[model samples]
Target: MIKCCNYDRKYPMAWDREDFSRAYRRLAPVYDHGLLLYELVGMRLRRYRREAVAGLHLQPGDTVVDLGCGTGVNLPLLLGAVGPTGRIIGVDLSPEMLEQAQRKIDAEDWCNVELVASDMVDYVFPPHVDAVLATLALATIPDYDSVIRTIASALPPGGRLANFEMTWPEAWPDWLVKLGAKLQQPFGVTTDLKDRKPARSIQRHFARCDSSERYFGAISFCIAIRQAGTGVNV
Candidate 1:
């Protein structure tokens, strides 16, 4: 279940936050199952998630914020990275989504996790947050630019942010890209996804941002470190 393809776009009208909220409300229960649709296309979801978590470079007892943490899909991986002593803060806008995540926590009997219902943009990063992660979540934001910058400003020294997301593929044939866009429409994704890339924003704030692309440019993974002194107050 991709909790994090958090959203934003240049054209604010592309997707209303309320609309996504409703979509997730209906999708909450079936979210994990629905993720199989990607696997059918060879998405290798678990592998990607593991790779993203590894990029965080977490240490035992380190804290991580899972932005747009849909249904807590990343919880186990994060908890594994930081161990029992470490803490995980999972945030999402959909209450129902959080409910589903809570169920998972209860079933697993994990005690170091916290779930918060809030939009990523207005989410207040608590003190000592070692890292922030947004998986499949950032592109959905209406102003990902500000969201990324604000998170950068809020992190302590050496803190990092890792964002993983999909985009309209540049390497695909024109006809294929169109077909892909149509398929994503039911999820409220528009042709605007082609312009939803946030790599530039990550590079702007971090002196060094590492990036990788997969699925022929349709998928991206980026990790940026907030240099000792960069960013303005959020």
Candidate 2:
């Protein structure tokens, strides 16, 4: 049965690495094409990012890691928030996407940003980050629990994890949801998580979790933090 607020049919299945790799390689060239649809979605994500990061109360020189950074869209905002003294590390799996991000960094001459092309789920940072964010990338990863566990293990108590994902719309007519799902199939986009139990999976690693659905049924933002007794040490 589908959950009330969030329904996801994607969980019971997993996609292989080759499949994910191919998609990333293919998306490298036309990534911007799909992003046009996200103009409204982007605004919503930005708001959530700003709110979540600001709530972290970062100092002038705090550090943050952008998991699945994908062309570094959030790099500029993160740079401004963290200030010149702080650092922003962007991690992604696509080299082509990272190349575009690199060009942007060079063109803008942003000294506080660092881009790393690697699978965020497996990449290890020497020093733990103060905050971690993954915008819409979590939904694509097959290993949701492991990814959350990795992020939780890499942050200190009170460190924040802000995630933006595509969620199923609740209260919408069932026909609309079904129609949307059918429309996305041709493009290989799945709407299963719009109804999946992301919160339940999150709760396994985080002591506190809260979510907000925004953009009139297009996106979901989840903010989770490790609690004091969770034994999450930096």
Candidate 3:
């Protein structure tokens, strides 16, 4: 049941097959240690948060949701950007990750973040959100269509969704990106989804979308805006 579009075993909050549950369960204990390398290298976490906020043009009162918001690396940056008037929601599938996220939120004394444990593919969202951002998380969900629809449905017309994911860049040499991604696959990160299916799916569901690639094609982001005049009454 666990096959990468390419990669698992089961535990609490595992959203996919039995393998995923087991893999995530094993990962939970050392996930932070494994991720520390990324944090140290090029300050990837900080950069992703910076890029996510900049892409969204976030405002003081806007509401934002971070799907698959593991350990809440982006929450502090987001809280600063949105300020006291705005709200932030962090949704994740792992209870252990959410515990880490809550610790980060408390350490920063942020009062506006609400972290929920849920699967990104089928989670129900509030009626309106100004923006949705997920970093290094979207490529994990193979059911891209349902995930995109859920994100789209959560936004009001004119709202935005910006996602930063590991992707292989079409413009760059593919071999290098693939090799780097392969090295990282064991830690629950991969670039296979970023190729065409994820990109095409976004364009099909959204009126306008764009992306920026960084880190020698190791990181990429997609930004989409809901049409303001859709008349769907978000």
Candidate 4:
């Protein structure tokens, strides 16, 4: 029998790091299949991933970091943009998720991609990354603000950051929003939808921020550019 992870009990306002890691461990094996509805039911989350990566405007031989990169869904896109000469550092908390990502790298014979199993909050940022991309993963991070600040500090001037994650829509009725949050609960999303606002946090760290909302405003894709002389010098 397949074991299911339970997260129904009360968690902190933000997810505990260990708790989040355990949750993704149980979900990793079937995680990609679980997202089929979003891909096939007109939601097309992959489109947002593509758009976000495109905003990076990467060149051959550039290095990029894929923060919270689950199952390497964003790898193919990143690989296409950076080419063989570039490097991709895919980071996640779950070893299981990173295992799945490793399989993809092996299958594609991609020598440039590296998988790092580490929490986003504590993971060391490599110097001079051309871009950082995270999709559908930021909302699950408990200390997302601090992570953004760290990214801002590590990136070179003019490095790009792109994030895509769930959002609570203002126009949606409270009942509908509640229902949506409930639907997403099993996937380890915070019960309170408002905590998923990465765009607002991104704006604070980045000088040029561009955002696009989709999926009835329940999803947001943001691309922000780190301006010269912004944040602490790393």
Candidate 5:
């Protein structure tokens, strides 16, 4: 039975690291290609990813952290944003996913990038970070709100973070919402995901939060800003 698919639903499920880790480990090697295959579903993920990074407007020397950095698909686009002097910290709970990401780092000889195998809930933020990027990720973490708070306070004034994710349409009928949940089950998407609202958290923590939806409201991308320092530097 589907409850109302609004963002106000109570008691969403928590992140089950063991189960999701196993699923992602198995999917790690194919993850990069796997996302692209969603093209058949009319998701232009590559383009969306590029736009997500571009929204950060990171400078040549800024540091950025990528949470749930599966196979490091966002690394290249991030590298392009910050240039050679910037640092990237990619965090994930799946070692297999980190391994695939490491391969990308090695293949490109990216000396400034670091990959850590840790859940985003426990991952620590480094100082002097100018931005954070989480693409198709935050909704999967049960404690994403806490993470958002940490980023908000730790970032030097005006630091940026981008969230790009999958979501139900704004006004889906109950039957359609149920069908959508069923179709997403194989990818580990759950009904409780409907209750996760990272944007609201972002709005609560950051001084400025700007968001837009695309793909018929099935996708939301938000860029948030902390208070104090201006854009350009951290």
Candidate 6:
């Protein structure tokens, strides 16, 4: 059965972390199944994940953080990239989501995976993290610019950040973009979809930023590397 929590408020103009936590608390169990349907329907969202992660170009023994790592779907790829000696810290706002992710770690006997339950804004990132990744998660963060700034500060110079998020292409009709936003509302996506360009925000903090759009311009992926001598004031 598909279970979901109550969200009586109107769709938010930006990320309401509390509401998203509540919604995902119930949605966690069936989240993977829902993604399967999304993929079958031609979204092929997992491809975006794979592409973004590959861009990180991770090495064995490196430590990586999977920001907003819902249900640990990227753990396998991360573990593969980093090898058994590497570590992965998966952070999410929902405890239920982390619970599911923990199960995946246990099932795979991955001794290096760590799951933390906290909002991205307040979470304490560890030092020496080689890369950070967020897939289909940044758009849900109301203060994504702040979050990007935090990530930039936490990483060492040349550290990588990869993100895959929703986007509305200029070529797409107004009606289609509206329809896309409407379809995403049930999943706690921000109502202001047109204004959430995560790639641009990421570029402000990084020296090198590479971005691409996929799924007919409905999705955008960005990989940025922190530059030397830049520090976040916050």
TM-score of structure candidate 5: 0.89
lDDT ranking, best first: 6, 1, 4, 5, 3, 2
Regions more than 4 Å wrong, model 2:
1-15, 40-43, 170-188, 194-196, 229-234
Which regions of candidate 4 are displaced past 4 Å?
A: 1-12, 229-234
Report the CA-based lDDT of candidate 1 relative to the real structure.
0.82
Relative to the true structure, candidate 2 reaches a TM of 0.79
Candidate 2, residues 157-188: lDDT per residue as tens digits?
A: 88888887766677767556656655544233
Tell me how many clashing residue pairs each candidate has: 15, 10, 8, 0, 0, 0
Q: Please give the lDDT score for candidate 3.
A: 0.71
lDDT digits (tens) for residues 161-234 of candidate 5:
88988877658775666677666654566667666788888888888889888788888889998857542211
Off by over 4 Å in 1: 1-13, 171-175, 229-234
Clashing pairs in 6: none
Which residue pairs show collisions in model 2? 6-195, 6-196, 7-194, 7-195, 7-196, 8-192, 8-195, 8-196, 167-194, 168-194
Candidate 6 residue-wise lDDT, 65-114, digit = tens? 99999899999999989999999999999999899999998887999999
lDDT for residue 206 in candidate 4, whole number 0-100: 83
> Could you tell me the lDDT of residue 196 within candidate 6?
79
RMSD of 2: 5.4
Candidate 5 vs candidate 6, TM-score winner: 6
Q: Score candidate 1 by TM-score against the native.
A: 0.89
Taking all chains together, each candidate's TM-score versus the true structure is 0.89, 0.79, 0.80, 0.90, 0.89, 0.90
lDDT of each: 0.82, 0.70, 0.71, 0.81, 0.80, 0.82
Q: Per-residue lDDT tens digits of candidate 3, residues 1-234?
A: 333324211111213434444456566667778777887777475666787778887899889999888878788778877889999999888777788888878887889999998878767888668889887777666676678776777788778888877666666555654566567755554545444345556666777789666677656668888878663222
What TM-score would candidate 6 get against the native? 0.90
- Provide the lDDT at 5 for model 1: 32
Displacement of the residue 92 alpha carbon in candidate 2, Å: 0.9
* Deviation from native of the Cα of residue 63 in model 2, angstroms: 1.2
